[model samples]
Target chain A: MLFRLTREDWKVILYNLGRMLHLLSFVFLLPLVPALFYRELDTLSYFFFTSGFTLLLATLLSHLCRTDEQMELKHALCLVALAWLAASLLASLPLWLGGACSSPLDACFESLSGFTGTGLTLTVDPDHLARSLHFHRHLLQFLGDGVGIVAVSLAVLGRTEVSSLLAFRGEAREEGIRPSVVRTTRLIFGIALTFFVVGALMFTLAGIYEGADPGTAFFDGICHSFTGYATGGFSPHSQNLMYYHGLIYEVVAMVLAVVGALNFNLHYALLTGRRREVFRDTEVRVFFFTALLLGALTILLLLGKGIYTSTEALFRRGIFQLLSAQTTTGFSTVPPLHLSLVWPLSLLFLLSLAMLLGGCANSTSGGIKSLRVGILLKSLALELKRPFLPRSVVVGERFHHLKDSPLTPPVVRGAALVATSYLLLFAAGTLITMAYGYTAEQSMFETSSALSNVGLSCGLTHPSMPAGLKLTYMVLMWMGRLEVLTVLVLLIALALSFQRRKAE
Target chain B: MKRTLLCLLLCLSLLPCAGATPVSVEDLVRGPQEWDGRTVTVTGEVVGRLERGGHVWLNLLDNGWPLGIWCTKEQAEGIRVVGDYFHIGDRVEATGVFRARCPEHGGEPDLHAENLRVVLEGRRVPRPVNLLLLALSLLLLGAALSAALTLRFRRKEPFLGYSPESF
Candidate 1:
């Protein structure tokens, strides 16, 4: 089927893909500033080399593929898939060259993890890695899966029909927040930048108050801000948020986590004086109540076990973890080993469920988004009412997002398909993990985390894990981030094109 | 004979005052069951700290597994910096009773230290500026700025068959 593509399709895909590569080249060079500032000359050299090579390759591709052809939906989807894969490979170069990872495959894994905003790490000891490299890892998450690469390109390249299709294919929301895609992209950047600055300042002050030096605090503040606002849970320190060990820092992180996971459309609406939408939006309401419910349940479980001696500990450790998991922000005050080894099974199950039912749709978070969950439940409720209704009774379901929209058949089907896809992906990963001899519960939890892009590990993700399982998780993270459809399209395209070539 | 007895008594007294046998962090984490309730000595760099109710919890990393050492305020004193992005934390030796799951602190695996001593003082990591890389970075920054400016100025052209006015 993919063999039906004309040269024009290839031109459009290559041209846009080249622009993305060029954009990424600029991004790669950004880490050079931190490397030079920290005097990590060795790591600085790798950034220079990789950035230069990418820029050169981008120029070549753009020059060769130069055409006025616009992108079709298939072209856009293929470009997005190829762009992500290429970006992952390019991002791995510096990591491998800097010796942050043990092998090229490990470096690729880290890059994929970062770009997916899944905070899994192959690096055994992050504490000893170069400061610039550590910052780069978090920065990747912010740029790649956080604000999104295609969105950034759209913001720079301006709005077009092709760019709009590309944006949709890139997993950015299709909501017409602004008249132009470019303007909407700019708005997204503006919101993210504003939050980044404010969040950094708050974290810096909190860190300094908690006894960190000004320089250390500022560096950590900015890095943490990027990850926090992106809902990418990487920390410069190996201990994650536990390294800070301050209530104020935890509170700052929590605030950013919640804000990051909120829908951009909601952010725009709220910023533009649509105050009532905050309370009326079904996704927002569902996310808030679900978080509260799970958090309370966690606290109660912790209390029942008499695990934590005081309410402070229960709230800080228990409540914080649940929120972190639900938001799909993997920051944790408690250690992963502790969670795996000592925490009650019920609490673990609750956390896994939270990971599965992630944050709001049209946000950076990954999972079967709360929007879909709310729709599914409403659909279920409508079905339950169908039995009681008399013959010839017309039933119409509606929910409020930006406005009151009918929960039509198409919308319900779309939600169900995506949610079911997520569950199937999670199940597949769980089975693979179990095949590797891991416990069923831990396997399910870890797989849910991977497929949801929640980076919480239950001591299952390690450098020494079975290579096949690691590969499975990388695929899961990729599929989860793209919402599965784009990847499936890319696969079918490749397969059909290859078969056509063989037949010829 | 009395002089010989006095020397022997002094040697015996010195043995009790000596530090406990050092245990690796890996061993402590892997065999917590065997190490539980047993007083042992461990030495590692203190990477993180949490203070509550007159005691401080220290995360000790010894190149292998990280272990937590819970110490009283007095024992935690004199440690100025915890390991982070910019500083190497003080290397400390802790003699404590290991708990695979402590009853007091939410079933966390930790060591309740009776004695803590700094073995090596950690200081600020040196980060001298690199002039060569700084110059290269400035060049790249200039190029990026120019590209951005060019794109901004050339907005009159329709992007991919969609005019801005269409919006």
Candidate 2:
């Protein structure tokens, strides 16, 4: 299986992976700033060692596997999966070595969660965690989702054709904003930067107003902004967003989450004076209506149960969770246990549905994206209407993304396949969790969370969870972030190559 | 007879004190059935707060899962800073009735405190600059900068050995 790859193919994979690691090494250095700022000397040492080691390894690989060949599609797919796995392992170094996690597996889980923008955590006593380490957690989310490491790597390498292919393989919908991949990546970063500044300011003011000190508020503001804008829900505090307890803070977070969940293409169109695109885009319409409908249902369910009697509580707690789930941002105003215990099964299922159908395509939010959901729903409606139409009539379907693209049979089939794959993955994870002695509701909720890349937990994810289950969730997160297909392709490629090797 | 009455009075005085069971935060979190609706005394560092109308919700951590401690605004007034990433919050002892599922707070696990006493005052955590690490970081950064500039001057991309528009 290993020999199935020619030297050139190995070079293509290793070289690109090395370039990515080289870029990632600089990111490791970034946490050092926070470490130094917080005067966390012990934590600072870990960052230094990890960064140096990563840089050294990257240099060695790049030098050894020097190649001029462009990456093939298979090589790109395999590289994308391997790079993410490698990055997750490497990133866990500081966490493990610093004694933040109980074991290397725990460290890897946390790192995978951060890199995949899944907010699940297994850190022991996050309240007492070093400031620098907390900052590093959120920074990883920013680097992983906000500024995609693969996209940034490709942008830096200036590989246009390969960059386009890797971007799609990495689950980003590639609609180039400019002629060059570098420019498009820059544009994405630019948009994220603008949102980061604005979000940080809003959160900072809200924190200060809510009785936090100026310095603490500012630190939290920057950290939360990164995670929030990425729709990556890793809070510095163990209590998550509920720690702030300010209505203003919650509202600002919601705004940032919704904005982050929006499609980057739509962001471009809106930013470049195509205001009508916001309303005309099918994904946007679907996301908006879906959120509203789910929000209403959640509020009614909570009210019916008398969980929160007041209108204020209904909107604040009920609607907030629905939005958080829908956006795939797992910021919780209520405790996870409370959500699991008090919420009706139907409400939990509804939230699971929201998670299963996540935010826009090419955005940080995960799951079978709104684009696919819209396509599938439209296709279903067309199928139902076709049978009732006159025999002579020809029914056609089209949907507006960047433009009105015709929804051909290939598009419908592709959408159906991906969505079905997601459902099956969710079901498999649920069964595995159930076999581990968790209740069906908890298993389904947690499985949906893992598969959708939504980090909301019903108390199933813990530091002491069975090792097998933890590994299951990690694989789910990885596959979820990659949109399942790329990981599938990598797996299939490996299998085929192994078979070929056996034949040889 | 007077001595016997005196002894009984002393015994009665001790009963009130003994009534409040001292328990770990973890015990209360795990065995809510045994402790719920019962008076318990817990000692921990006060962390994070949510201000309600007349009271505040405080999270108390003692090297275990954080347990919510609900106290009046007047009771919480003594806390200067809540434990967080930057500051160490006050360590305190709370005597309260534990509720496994608080009805008022939407089935949240909480403690309704009758009394709270600060055991230790929290202060701003010291963040002295580490000169050794700082120097090393600066050195590494400088080296990286030098390498990038060298690569750029050599007409190669700084990070990836290709011109920006070449592709």
Candidate 3:
């Protein structure tokens, strides 16, 4: 009750935050290459200014907070929370300056969406955006989702061993593959690189097979691979995957999304020759079963009303949409208007469930995560078994993830708390959207898509959308990306800080 | 006989011409079934092109949203300007069979063009550099570089007693 975070506590937080800014200064400069390539060099000054400004700020903050002190768990938590907001704010500068966004808030929304790997966009007419700016949008996803910003900053630049690892945990990427966080980050980066190389190559071939020139194919291939493996759905074309109009390209995207969403621990097991974890893991089973249920319902709905005539159409439009949502990847073969206007309500609701029950935990995908969902369901089953047991009998169960892990009370409760928080936030976002005169179904669909960090939209997201809704979805994307608790901690810290300020 | 001929002419006038009654791509996307397999006219700026064996795929941008059009190579050859970062694309009107699900190409929603005509020639999009914006950019950039350079060379002089390990 007496807890008060003094300014002294923020010294370490701001210091590490500056370390993150050091990496971000380079991020701002990334778009300049594409600008040069596309001959949009007139806009190059914006990137230079943003990069230089960030570098100066980072230098200043580091000097101000310079001390021979280490961060504790609380400091790490606050740093992770503060870093995302700060990075998004700094990241929006180039986007706004490039004239891609309609307003500052819209650019901020796009920046957060890209930074969180939430593909929702308010960038006005992305189809006409400058080439370098378009590349920056995709690059944001690669840094945030593929190589986690927190993990990379801490692993590469963080000086303190204990606190750096704590920051990794606070970022929800603590499933380490090695003893040291640096080694783990390196291994993860290696895995991501291997996948990116292979995926890009395959996508390029697919694009060529579908009748594209080498230049466009190679360009789209590299960019798609970045967002695809990140499970961060962003595309240069406004039409998303429908721009390709190729079945093969859609297939490649689906495979990449699934690969991105797989549990990293399982990937480690398979690399170490423990191949059985693919089928034996409880989290993996939950993901498949849920996918199967949702996919079947969606496909059945498509076929029931004669949405398409042939198998190819069914696969590209129907199956692709379901898998995209299940992976929490926002790539769509259908237009937003089509999804909102023509798709059956039941199918939209099914897609909502798919988005809400996203891929496995500790993966790039976001939702209540498969492992948590599995634990909650198992706990429910254990309770169901209670009525038949003797009064004194205490039943305990275990589920296999990377190994056999007990369904402990704390684990179940944590899962429940997170799930409850997600649903409540979903409700709040839906209510705000409804208050703006959208239908209940439309509100629910868009809210879940944003809160689950699945970038799919049902015609509710656009540049002309209410700014209030834009702020709401931005906050939702941030909270959902961090799995709520980190943001909640930041909020409580802010409140306590203000209370302390008033008391003084 | 005169009345019958006049009535036929009236009916003919009721139907839309090749360039008339241009259907909205958004409308077709929202209600594909209603327009599926129907002959329709569409007008948009040609933005991108992809060559097939004998045909070419042109992405016609209607107010910044793209609608794919499958046209013969001859039709695509007439397109002199394709839009990108630098220039406005050729504005063209095409009469085609709008497919809700094109079976030939992965069931993608597209139009198979029967006729094409360029209505407007595209030119270089005006990109006037605002002097005010350029000035602000230079000033901010200058300030940033100066700050970075000053801190790098003289931070130790200000805090000479500070330990290097602290950072």
Report the C-alpha displacement of residue A330, candidate 1, in angstroms: 0.8
Candidate 2 scores a C-alpha RMSD against the true structure in Å of: 4.4
1 versus 3: better DockQ goes to: 3
Instruction: List where candidate 1 sits over 4 angstroms from the true fold.
Output: A1-3, A158-161, B1-23, B27-38, B48-58, B68-90, B97-112, B120-167
Q: Per-residue CA lDDT of candidate 3, range B43-105, in tens?
A: 888777777789888888887667899999997788998776677889998888988778887
Error of 3 at A82 (Å): 1.5
Every candidate's fraction of true contacts kept comes to: 0.07, 0.15, 0.49
Candidates, ranked, DockQ: 3, 2, 1
Question: For residues A344-402, what per-residue lDDT tens digits would candidate 2 score against the true structure?
Answer: 78888988889999999888898898998999999999999998999999999999998
User: Which residue window of length 10 is worst by lDDT in model 3 chain A?
Assistant: A1-10
Most DockQ-accurate candidate = 3
Q: Pairing residues by index, what is the TM-score of model 3?
A: 0.93
Decreasing lDDT order of the candidates: 3, 2, 1
| Quality of model 1 by C-alpha lDDT | 0.80
Q: What is the DockQ of each candidate?
A: 0.18, 0.23, 0.38
Clashing pairs in 2: none
The digit string of per-residue lDDT tens for model 1 on B1-167 reads: 99999999988854532655678977776666677778788899988776656877788888746777888888899788777546798999888788766666544567888778898998887655456764675565455444533443455434333455653
lDDT of each: 0.80, 0.81, 0.83
For lDDT, candidate 2 versus 3, the one ahead is 3
